[model samples]
Target chain A: MTAALSTGPITAEEWGIVSLSLRVSAVSVLGAAPLGFGVAWLLARGRFAGLVVLDALVHLPLVLPPVVVGWLLLLGFGAQGPAGRLLADWGVTLMFRWTGAALASAVMAFPLMVRAMRLSIEAVDHKLEAAARTLGASRARVFATITLPLAMPGVLAGLVLGFARSLGEFGATITFVSNIPGETQTLPLAIYAALQTPDGEQAASRLALIAVGLSLAALVTSEALSRRMGANVHGL
Target chain B: MGFDIDVFLQRGGGQIVARFSSGAALTALSGPSGSGKTSLLDMVAGLVRPDAGRIAVDGKVLFDSAAGVDLPPHKRHCGYVFQDYRLFPHRHVEANLLYGWQLAAPRDRWISLSEVCELLGIGHLLRRMPGALSGGEKQRVAIGRALLSGARFLLMDEPLSSLDALRRAEIMVLIERIRDDLGLPILYVSHDRNEVTRLAGQIVHLGAAHGVAFATDMSQGEQGKACA
Candidate 1:
């Protein structure tokens, strides 16, 4: 174990979990970004009676215990659930799989993404939008060029925050997909499994270091990216 | 094309009624500080709905409360330059100038970016952000942005009020050039009688007590006496 720790490659199985964690989290964030953007725009800019209800619903994951959210996902998308059955009939099964892990992480990370983006969208100047209208730009075009560009810093922040949330997503992912090796065993799940075994000290420590390194790297990258984006839009 | 307007607006502690018809290439809306000059511009731009009105631009009915024909600002084909020079803070001078240019339909593309840049003398500042620009430079950029769109009419709401005397005089000279070169009908709004005399071929005087009055084809001295 000491020799393995000193100077050798992590086991292929450990590498698989690392790769799986990355894949699940990346897929989670990418899938959520655009949808989060839309929902956030609506919440920030829209005025309607149903908006309160929608805002609450979108933020439900943040307030709920992670396990409860996972249980809800299981109940809604399990094979016995109507949606799960429909997807099953269509040859797509999400139960106890990597896709399920991603799905769970995306849901867990959604509120952070939306909140960040919403704040950014709200910060955009409505006067500029009015000017764009007078200049013959349609509402969609104005949003694409003006509102989105102005809101990019918040969007980037949300992307990084959601990514970190997905990386560390534990309870929802475990309850929704169940920890299965080579399929749903993300870094967190693999670490948990290592703790349960007799001789997984080296493996767990290695995985922990990798997870910390990745998160720190992500934080640094996002800070620089968002700073540059802010300067591009607003100038120094 | 000309604008014919009869608009009623409800404001604090009073109501505003404006009625005027303008066909001149450089029609000026001269009014006291409390008069509804800017609000009238807003109604024409579709930024504010009138309580009751029939407004037509160049024989096109832009808004008719009785007929229920209210075209939105994007469909109005009117360019606006505001007092505050509302250039997009995120965009550089060039992007702000082109904000409406690409959105203009191909056949309606009357003014080119190079022409506007040359006219406004903002060609060198295209790469710079709006925040870094001087107030005079910002106003020039704003005018360029407004004119780059393929709109047939221009609305200036105290466009020179924010600048110093030197800058204001400089832009006034530029406005004369714009009038001669572009030949689009411009509606210039200002309270300054001197601005009205210099830029307007026709003047609509607006006051809280009188509402609106129109007069045309008088010498500057005669017009100054008439407005006074």
Candidate 2:
């Protein structure tokens, strides 16, 4: 396998893997953010029965093995599963598809996103919201104009963290969607595949460097956004 | 314009029972610390729910336990000037002023942004953030914010307590102008007897026992007379 691998440059095939990884991570973060924020808000402020259970459920992925999470996703969204059957009626499928990979990434990234968002939402002074209410702002308007803006830095951090987590996702994505070449072969999967060969060390190293670069960029972006937003909220 | 308030609230280890009515432009609530002055204001602003009783301003019933009417804070339209000013720290002075103004119905709105800014002398501070504002300036902005929201009445909870003597006097004159010119009923909270005597038309004292005593100061003229 090492003899057959090209150690020169990132081939077009490798580029496809990088692109697919980026797409999967972006889609996962975008799709999960609203749900994450809602869950975070509920955990932060909502008072209700079974709250502890809901919290535990939200954080289940963080503690559970990634393979178990993937297996759970497969059970719920695979072609023959209940949700999968319902989706199939709508002419949609997730099995071995990039969409399935995105779903797996989203599930794995959700806990981190929710945690960051919850902390931020909790930090927002309830007094400000009460003041808004006194000023004739409805609950929705108060959240939109005051609470959400004040929590922007946390929300940004959650998004970047989720995106990075999704990019590096290997166990869940591989277990759920498998390593299909163009459809689901993300960077981690490609790097893993390269490592399995005897002469593919150089190829794996190159892909690993790319992964490191991408994660660094995401973190830097998060820091920059959080700093700017924190300044806007406090300075202005 | 006046206030008719009788509310009962159960706090930790005690109950807060307040009953008073005033037919005056400015009704003062004078009490020592921990006498439920702020709690009563919170009830009027719908921030705190009373166990039972009624809250009416200018003949408009805001909360009536018997009638099962409990309007939310947004619908009550009681402009509150908190002791700490409670200005939205993230918003500029202008945005804070406009927050309520934008929410008010056109027919309900009686004061414009420019008018409030001019009246409170906060026009020059509009672009400044609440973080950068002095205590006096923040209080003025808070007052302007409440007024611009189309408030039918005002609730000032020790609005001058956090200010210096000079700023307190300045705001006292501004409050007088608002009372005489705008004609909006004001429920002012203060611990200083002299300050209340200078500004309040009628004074209601809250004792340490949680009892309320109504006083009509003849020196303040007929406008200071309470009906009950």
Candidate 3:
């Protein structure tokens, strides 16, 4: 415990890890939210051919091992992969970079977000949407007005869950981006590295505590925000 | 000068058929439960597509199988007040009224928001959410939202059914006032014969279970033969 205190509250290296974790998580959430919303809406309301297949496919990532996902990302986004070559030529290299780390985190956390969003969208009353239609609102307008506002609570929950998941992502981020210091080293990766060192156990424990604090803080913030919005919508 | 819908719809596992070619402006489809009344209105609202039929309103073709035309729900300029008063619970009353106004064509903007709010007596609840309002207030908001849509044809699917007796009585006078003042042609659906007598200009009666449906002018008391 004295050794933990001696390691200091926020060393430069530890701070780097904390900020990188936050940045990666934020980027991943922003990139994945709209896609999650669309996928969830489809799973909830859309009735077409292959709907069951699509639902199963979207949930596959949640059940798959994070290491496997990292391996798939490496195969698809490596320097020699088809998509990687095109991206490289366009000056947008993702392999082994911080962006690749974020992408990996997004892939791992996507299923949770989609699941939350799907449930909320399904809970929205279809009668309201039909009424909006008769009121001359188009499909997009109706969704924006009626569906989106009502489903915001689930969306907020998904965002918090995704951000927390992304912040702690280890296996996928390391496998996909190689856990480089000052670049791909997120909080979890830094903690793992510290634990592997002979005298770095103190630093690792501190980082682990910070990770726990972050997850709890994220959850609290999400709940507070959702409650405020819900109250506002409910006129309380 | 209003519209003509000449269609024959098979009802109840094809055991009965109801045919109508009426061009009346304010037609009321009224009957008891399981009378195929809602289905008849759905056919006009472009919700439930007919197998072989043609629907025209004010010389505009809505669904014409002969011409291979079927306008979807969004394209139809029809205002609807659902039986459950389907007000969007997430939105404020103002946003609910604006939703339809934004979707209307630039040239089709006939009804103003102020006019609708004034008519429905919901001007004070503009910022209020649906959950905050009473049952009667929600129905009035729903009616106002429907009317602000600039719909050429208005359809009310038992709009007053969910309200209490006192609220229903209040809304009944409001409906009558809307009919007389606004001059908006409406297609109102109800199961109550008293409501039909009170509000219907052209009444279309539907039978229970597997039976026929035919139209008559309730105001003139013309009873046409009920075809089986």
Candidate 4:
């Protein structure tokens, strides 16, 4: 338990944790994007009863305790749950697995993703869509060509934000998937585990630095993409 | 192309009641501000639903309240040139023009992309984005986009309202060529008396009170007399 000043390359175990974290975060963002876009579009444009309820439900993750969100996921998707059984029938299991960790991260990052995309979708001019319609472009065509392209900056921002958030997810990941080494122990969880060891401050700090770097990279990439997309869209 | 439009729309506080039919190639909707010229055009384009009445272009019914037939905007085949020229700003001139053109059925596409570009004199701007275009160029692109979509007729809502005097004159001439050469029917909305008098084969004056006055039989020779 002696604290040794060991300045060395990242160990194989640390690389496993880093790579696992990257995979989990990437999968979560990829899995959530399409659904987030659909929900955001509905929130931005749909006029119906229960719209407020849908909006509130989509934003619940942002306000709810991460532990509670994880518990709810367990109830809805654990091995013994109804949805879990339905998925089991399809040979899909999301319990104490890397996929489960991805699911937790996706749930944690969904609110931010949807909010950003919805704002951009709402900002698109309905008049342009109408013009497209008058030009004999169908509703689907108008959305794909005009609405989606115009809203892309926000979509890209949402993906980057969600990816960064997913990378940092800890409460839900540890609760839902139990922080298994090389599976659920993402950057934040690995940092927590390292800090809990008797002489692991240096290791914990290294993991912490990597987390900061990844988040910074995500943010900078999002900013650059948003600027380029904004110029393309607004010609400014 | 000809138009048979009789629509009544209940907007916020006021009611819009318009009734007119013309067989002219270029029929102008002339009225002061607050008059529902744009609304009438919207009804014809299937953007605004009329509370009552029918809209038909060249014997083809687009909307009919009695019959419960309201074609959606895409099915109406009416090329709308909005006041602001609602070109897809993200798309280059060629792509914007091709958006509708590609969607049009092969048989339905009466005008080719090259033909539209030549007609509108926008061939030189194929690669430029909408933001890079001047007011007149954007207007031409907008027109070309509509025409390439195989529009059965055109709905021009204040097409020249956003242009300068010089651009307006240029577009006026371009519109005349489109009317006479292409022979596509046009529903031109404007408040400018000179534009209406100079361009319209038939004029329907809309009043602020929502009354529509038809000045039929106003051919090119009688346009000055009708304006007087």
- Identify the candidate with maximal DockQ: 4
Candidate 3 residue lDDT tens string, A1-37: 1245645667666777889899999999889999988
What TM-score against the true fold does each predicted structure earn? 0.88, 0.92, 0.87, 0.92
Decide which is better by lDDT, 2 or 3.
2
State the lDDT of candidate 4 residue by residue for A1-236, as single tens digits. Answer: 13424576767777788899999999999999999999999999999999999999999999999999999889989988899999999999898999999999999999999988998898788999999888887898888888898999989999999999999998888888897777778889878987899778988887887789999999998888778666765661
Error of 4 at B23 (Å): 1.7
The candidate scoring highest on lDDT is: 2
Deviation in Å, model 2, residue B62 alpha carbon: 0.1
lDDT of 1 at A140: 86
TM-score of each model's B chain?
Answer: 0.90, 0.93, 0.87, 0.91
**Deviation (Å) of B69 in candidate 4:** 2.0
Question: What are the RMSDs of all candidates, in order?
Answer: 3.7, 2.8, 3.5, 3.1
Candidate 4 vs. truth: CA RMSD? 3.1
Candidate 2 lDDT by residue in tens digits, A1-236: 23324457666766888999999999999999999999999999999998899999999999999999999889999988999999999998998999999999999999999998998898787878888999999899999999998898889999999999999998999999999889999999988988887778878888898899999999998788777666655552
Worst-scoring 10-residue span by lDDT in model 4 chain B: B219-228
Candidate 4: how close is chain B to the reference, as a TM-score? 0.91
Measured against the native two-chain assembly using Cα atoms, what DockQ does each of the candidate structures obtain, in the order listed?
Answer: 0.59, 0.63, 0.50, 0.65
lDDT of 1 by residue, A1-236 (tens): 12246246776766788899999999999999999999998999889899999999999999999999999999989999888998998999898999999999999999989998898788777877888889997888888887788888879988998998899999999999999998999999988988777887777788888889888987887777667666655551
Q: Model 3 over residues B176-200: C-alpha lDDT tens digits?
A: 9887777666778898878877887
Ranking by DockQ: 4, 2, 1, 3
